[model samples]
Target: MYFYNLLSKLKYIFTLVITTPYYGWIIFLQIISGFFSIAGIPMLIPVLEYIRTDISGAEKQGHMGFFNYVFSFIGVRPSFYSVLIVSSVLILLGQILVFVSTTIAQFAQIKLSGEYRKKLFNSYLAVDWLWLTRDKSGEMNHAIIREVELASVAHLNSQRIVIYLTQLMVFLALSIKLSFKVTMLAFVIYGFLIIINAKNTSYVQSLSENFNETFKRLSTLTANILQNKKFFKSSIAYKGFVSKVFHCIDQTMHTAKILNIREQLQISWTFLVTFTFLICLIMSHRILRVGFSELLVVLLVFQRLSPQFSSLFENYLALNKNIPIHQSITHRLNDIKKNKELCGDEIYQFNKSITFKEVGFRYPEGKRVINNINLEIKPCQTVAFVGTSGAGKSTILDLILCLLKPARGTIFYGEISHDRLDIFAFRKEVAYVSQ
Candidate 1:
């Protein structure tokens, strides 16, 4: 259910699933290989115990299930020795499969990470100029890098979730073979672990925001140093720039240290639960009158289950933490996307002159950058505008180029409001080279 919500927002889910055979194939193979490894565990403990006792006839008792089924099919009676040999082979093969699968996943992760980074870069490149000015360069850097890193981390962690889920299932089957009561106890403990981790979602989200802010401050500090290097090196300002970078780094480290401390505290709770589970096993052994093998089975099951459950909860918390950052970055990106210039519109056709009639303009904040004005230009005439600095000269050019729309009056080309003309198309027909 956690994954259900997680996967819902990532647009790349379909791509990830469809490419699973391509990207996550090794992981799937490892899971299949791991099943054999888990099943062999039950067989192993008994064999070793029998060997320790030096019993001669105990050989027949150890060889059962898959070993017997496969060997019997091949018209061979799998001796205790033979089953032991076969199980070792299966275990070795499974180990190799898991290693290879993880290796492949890491490689695929790098490729996908690069692809996403490229897409983000292209999206930024295609957007309008306004975004470049509105968003500080450092903040954009912070957002882009944070998203890329998270996407990579999430993708890798997501793959592991599959591996862990497979391992859990194998362990669940083994636990069922041991005792239904023990398995149920383990399941309840796992559910509790999940709830504990889920409760930390708000903290995780807050941490993510803090992390981004730290990086942004650092990025801004760095950018300023680079841009003002001359000013820094020429005067006593060098110390000031150095001080700012240190200040940002100091804040970044402070937040980071707090998060690390919290994580360590959380780990203590895991240890507490593990100790409780161990106590539960002891009580269950005496109450249920379970044999040594059954006790060993429960212990082994808990050994695997504790780490699995703990990891599941930790990963969920981490995912929740990262999702908010991912969402924030995406929101900014989408805003940039929405602010993009319109494409594929019909080019406006004008055969006569261009004119501005009783025109006026003001910025969005209502600072009047332009005053009432009337102007005309013939189809093929060269004209010049003369005015002092801040005398609405640049504003007039901005209005004509359609970079800024006038708040009052009209600009006409052949008696039509120039606003109706495709601004992009109009710009192509007329070039205004500015100083």
Candidate 2:
């Protein structure tokens, strides 16, 4: 049962990620960049072969691709020097493609940042008054500002992950085409190394989650401490606040340290594995009499592949880190959508008295905030609710405003229950001041 539950949650997280906002054109650009990146791999093969012997003979005898033909048609001779320049320029162009694609993707993210914050704010405004008071506190403010920002970032980070994955696919395909046996051997070694470091990835993800939680708590604490600074002037209150703040910071630093250590360990492990693979390739080449050109190409692939895998791994971890923020904001938005305070179809025309009759209310903890309250107010007549703090004054006004539904009895505008009145129109005609 636990395994199935975990499986379901994993499915949901990935589904949420893929469904997040992404620019289709930017993704297409990255896809094109992937091909551009892969072109350099094949272009290197002949260049390496050309370097093994006489450059003129190697170039005159070697097969060249369409790019070589284009250079030739433009009056550039096909030779080792030409192939060398072509490969370097092609790689440079690929870098440009990646840069251009990332820039556009970032632009899309900047546009979405405002949109996501607006989405969260509008959702907050639409939430039932009772729900806000009932649910857990400290999550709302940070989620609205910080987590929503993180959510906007998820689209950009997710796009980067997709681009990395695309590049990996292209690199792997071309490396295999260039030298099947070497590619297969490298894949096994690197695949095994990745499996070994999979636990580290999970650990990093766990640490990221802890860091996110700590940061949110810190935000709440900072706000709370500043608002209640009077309490903190005393040594006892100051000590308590300092203790909590320090604990949160200490925990955050500890988690960050662990993540950093894991990253270092993973990088060190990748270096060791790649080095071992190179040695084994050399030994295998000596036995199989593999061509030097193949060795050089394989070495080139390994050099690029090592960093690719490392970055891809890091990006995968980023996906995990961003998932919670996305889910936090999205789940809140979705919950509001599901449990919204729906308005009635009735048009509100209030020119008479608003009355509350035998209304009772309690909080989620089952403590009554308002009990058996009765009040009435007429048009053009101002009234005040005067009570000590935490008395039912604000709750009563909220009840009158239709922000909170009564647990017992009714609130009426004229003869109609407030629920039947158009809430938007009613609120527009009414306003409240709070303590």
Q: Pick the candidate with the highest lDDT.
A: 2
Q: Candidate 2 vs. truth: CA RMSD?
A: 3.7
- The digit string of per-residue lDDT tens for model 1 on 266-359 reads 6678768877987878876877666665677578667876776667556555655565555666677688788775433445555677788889
CA lDDT, candidate 2, residue 227? 69
Q: On a 0 to 100 scale, what is the lDDT of residue 364 in model 1?
A: 58
Candidate 2 clashes: the total is 0
- The TM-score values for the models, in the order shown, are 0.75, 0.84
RMSD of every candidate to native, in Å, equals: 5.1, 3.7
Q: Evaluate all candidate structures by whole-model CA lDDT and list the values in order.
A: 0.68, 0.74
